[model samples]
Target: MLDLVAVLLALGLLMYLAYRGVTLLILAPAMALLAALLTGGLPILGAYTQIFMTNTGAFIVSFFPLFMLGAIFGKLMDDTGSAKSLAGSVSAWLGPERAIVSVVLCCAVLTYGGVSAFVVAFAIIPVAAALFRAADIPKRLMPGALALGAFTFTMSALPGSPAIQNAIPMPFLGTTAFAAPGLGIITGLVMLLLGLAWLNRRAARARAAGEGYGAHADGVPGPDVAMREHAQGEGFDIAELSGDPAPGKPHRDGNLPPVALAVLPVVVVIVTNFAFIRIVIPMLDTAWLAEPLFGATTIESVRGVWAVIVALFFAILLLIAGNWRRLADLRASLDKGADASVLPIFNTASLVGFGAVIAALPVFDLISETVLGVGGGNPLMSVAVSVSVLSAMTGSASGGMSIALDSLGPTFVDLAHATGVSLDAMHRVTAVASGALDALPHNGAVITLLTVCKITHREAYGDIFIVACAIPMLALAVLIVLTNLLGSF
Candidate 1:
């Protein structure tokens, strides 16, 4: 009982620290270590080893490079006005009356292609700025809709969302890729329709209400940083990235040849990912390979790290030219780009580590014992519902999942061993459950987007909460029912 209290206290402390804006990477692990000390784990040595190994592992960090790869592509798209061109091309097809729907579609597709919401936001916002401007829509309204487009279904309920926050739970749950694919696809399509419908209606309502209809229309959209509300700090020099503050000058009816600008980074990242999988992964399959390095890592982990480094290199080139103007201007631009990504990365990393500590220690184990005692007959439902409720309370998908997964992941593995369920299914349930609950008003990602986009928590969040919570909760119930019904077959 005391162990359970210690664990919950640790989780609560970490969550509170995150809320207070402490460095998550630093604080979360600290909370975990503190918890371990209270619980009397394998040893202080074991806890330290676990924290370092998990937090700093190459596989753990491969996503950082992936992010760099994605961010560079987004940054280029933002700067070159290419994203607007893409948005423009799509809007041209979808028609003005349906422009908002089109933007949502674009966001959904790009995000489903494995982009994070932050990357999607940076990439989409500028283009949305252009598309909305052309359609006479307000920029403030665009962020909410755009965030929904990228996040709502494709991220929360859909298949193959590359969100590590979502994907990491799969192995823990005992589900298969094939198990939930059909349901996930249907959910995405249904969600896409619902989102578009809601957004279109909102656009119409705003238009009819005539509140700030034409107010603060002071910007041109596209990669024109000179035209943006530049954030303070040493970030990128907008002048170099923006290439002259003049939104005019008819620079030409054309920019970089579309092929080079449009596809370079994407192609580069794909090649790197494939190359590492095929060429590098097999090379590490030997006994001697372990000793050649510092013995701290296997070639596999190093390969992952190297791949990220290469991706970032290509990314820097994709964003900046080799000329004097770009160099003189890069310091500020690079700094700014780094700034956009740094805090979020650090925050995510810290939270993940803290989550690891909580899990690796007995805190999670203590919770599981308690839940199992109370779960009674329908353990699966109990697990899902309890996780969902806790996540919603905290307004964090990953954080809540971390707490739940750490506690129950091993137990679920044991259950799968006994019941013949797949870990992948369990992972899916945990992930879906986390994102669903995270629809709460205070979830950092939701709150951040709302704050940055200048929307009230009141205006849009309630609708989002309904979508996040209702759809997935019901979906999970239906899945369980069908699973049982079909198991008879």
Candidate 2:
């Protein structure tokens, strides 16, 4: 009982502190030790070194390549003006009347193409701001628009998205990113359509209220606004326009590239990713993958991750090749990307480490039994509930999913096999489940999106919660029911 209290307390503290902006790198170990001391009869330092660091290191080793490449690809897209060109073209084609849909679609395209969600937020905000202002939509709706696009479908439910949320479940389930394609498409569309309808209704309400891009002191400054303020009417400087180039640097081409050239790299990532998973990997003789050095892993175990890596690598090369002249410093962009991946990977790894220590405790057995039993003989319900709760508690979709899977994944796998459920079903359901409750107000991604758009939670978080959290939860429920009825595809 005392052990349970300590563990619960530690979890609460971790969440509260994370919400308060404490670094998880420091918070995770401290909380783990606290829980360890309360449990008693354990080597505290050894737990930190052996359990925590080992798990953290293992996560980094497994995922570092994807993180690095994804970041580089996103950065290259941003620096080369491809992201803006994509956003601008989409916004233009959709026109101001369809501003909400346009912003969401642009974000979806960028994220589905492997751009970091963080990068997508920064890349699309200026465009989103301008479009909203032009359409007479409330500025407060910007975060929800961005969240609906970046956080919901593309981040989790999309078939070939390179987001870590989609990739994290692959090895555990021995499934590809294309897992449960039918279910993924169905759920993705559900969230997309429902979220759009909600946002449009909100827009209609605002219009009825006679509200039009209500002024905010910290609202994102659009390039058009900047151009209007400048006495010379010189148009936006490169940095001001795309928000990529650093000041005091020699300016490259400020003009948006041809739409085809701008969008091709993204297309490359998606197409190459699908091809690698469906065609190339199947043709390879992967018998050596069963060796101890490879952890006796099979092609399915690594195919999903490998597909994304190759896709991102090729896309990065294409981005560089096409935008070589426009990039002010290719090396700087790569270095920035490499540097960008460190915090997110480490943050998630810290949570994984924390989970490892917690799992080692005797008390964890009780918690696990309760969580595992919640499904009452249904693996889908068990996975969905456990992952959703952990994700909400952690305020990170990836971190929460990693922790839950690391601790309970094997048990879930056994449950699935015994119940005759497909691993692909398990994989897709878990991935989608993580995205649901993980959009709680304290979620790092949500907070970052709000901060980037310079909107207060009061003005925007309600809409975000509805679209990203509530709608996704509904989609998860439907998915669970569909899987139970139709069985996995």
Candidate 3:
């Protein structure tokens, strides 16, 4: 069909652009515009834009405000010595025996707090290197292990995931984090087990296979070269080293408070999602968990926004209650937050925009439509493969999700509605696959960890690819078996 040909050309071009670092944030909506022009011409593009506005409402451009807030909260914590206080407390309790795991856990907590994956990777890799060497775990294990820790919960199923990889589909699918709590929890636990298992297996394989895989990308004799190289950056600033609260005077052990503060945003989003969708929305014409503040936005859009607001609110309260001890430095903290957020905000929006346009094209329609018919029988697998394929094509997990969120999201959901899959199952599987595959190539989280750990795609990424690419395939198979054999209830 001419429609199919036009669609393919657009998708191919979109993929090429995505590979060039244009990002799904920009690529998505832009592609949507292209697809419209190619398929139904300009009129269709106008209609889709109208639909986008209705979906985004007036708050489309403001979505990143929450991310900014979360970043601000993180900046304040670091500036005020809150983060270190929290890290120190936990390190003490964890002991040197489980130091690597402790670092990973700490990083995960911060990720939930809304820090970028790159920031987490850079900050935490050094800690992992120190702790792993301390525990006699060897440097090489740091990259894979750190990657595992950071990617596990955050990638798959964290509530209030600031990543936007998973949440972007919520408005269309009617699947909020609250709707699949049990599934997400189980998925996370399964991934953690798999990650730990891989660690043990890889260590054994390395011992058996000989570390002769060579010094690895960071050019070290061990797996840790990646981590070592990243930490060697331009000496430490005094501000970063000594912002601790008076060096002593009753701290939250430097571990618990920062950890808790960091994790609070995610918890608020996940827990509130269910209540907002199931309990509140049905009662009112429209429900915005953040309605009081932002006036009736969808939870997905508002989740990041509200959590950051809450983080800011709590951050300020903590600062004021702590007697405005760091009040003079507040301006410095704000600037730090803004500086870090610019890249993520710019990239994400552009990437999402591009995907929106491409999906609206005949190429997306033809591919999506064809996949829908094939996947109609085994929806979970269909969704997984599509996301992974797109991710690999784009080199970003979140980017891959953006592609599916536009072209495949509605198609898959409609198929599920028509076929026999439960909405909850579909939602859970979608998030899991998105998080999992995002582990490969362009996944910012995986890339950050690798860059810091000084490992290369050849050495460590193969391991991640195995897990990210393979697990979702396995999950899809299982879902197919369960739904087909056991039947959806």
**Best prediction by TM-score:** 2
Indicate the worst ten consecutive residues by lDDT in candidate 3.
229-238
Model 3 lDDT per residue over 213-306, tens place:
2432332122133222222221222233223332322222333245554344445544454454556555654354556675555655444344
RMSD score of candidate 1 (Å):
6.7
Query: Against the hidden reference, what TM-scores do the models get?
Result: 0.68, 0.93, 0.72
- The alpha-carbon lDDT assigned to residue 261 of candidate 1 equals 46
TM-score of 2: 0.93
lDDT winner between 1 and 3, please give it. 3
* lDDT tens per residue, model 2, 1-489: 888999999989998888777778999889988899899735898999999999999999989899888878887887888988899899999898899999999999999998877778767887898889889899988899999999999888878888899999998898878889899999999999999999999999999999998775543444332122221111123354334545523223556677798899999998999999888988999999999998888887889899999999999999889878778778877887777778778888999999889888889999898897889989999999989998898888888899889999999999999999999999889999999999887777776677668777898999999999999999999999999999877
Comparing 2 and 3 by lDDT, which wins? 2
Give the whole-model CA lDDT for all candidates, comma-separated: 0.54, 0.85, 0.55
Candidate 1 off by > 4 Å: 1-13, 33-82, 129-141, 170-179, 201-214, 217-346, 360-363, 370-396, 399-403, 468-489
Ten contiguous residues minimizing lDDT sum, candidate 1? 225-234
Model 3 RMSD in Å is 6.7
| Number of the predicted model whose lDDT against the real structure is largest | 2
Candidate order (lDDT): 2, 3, 1
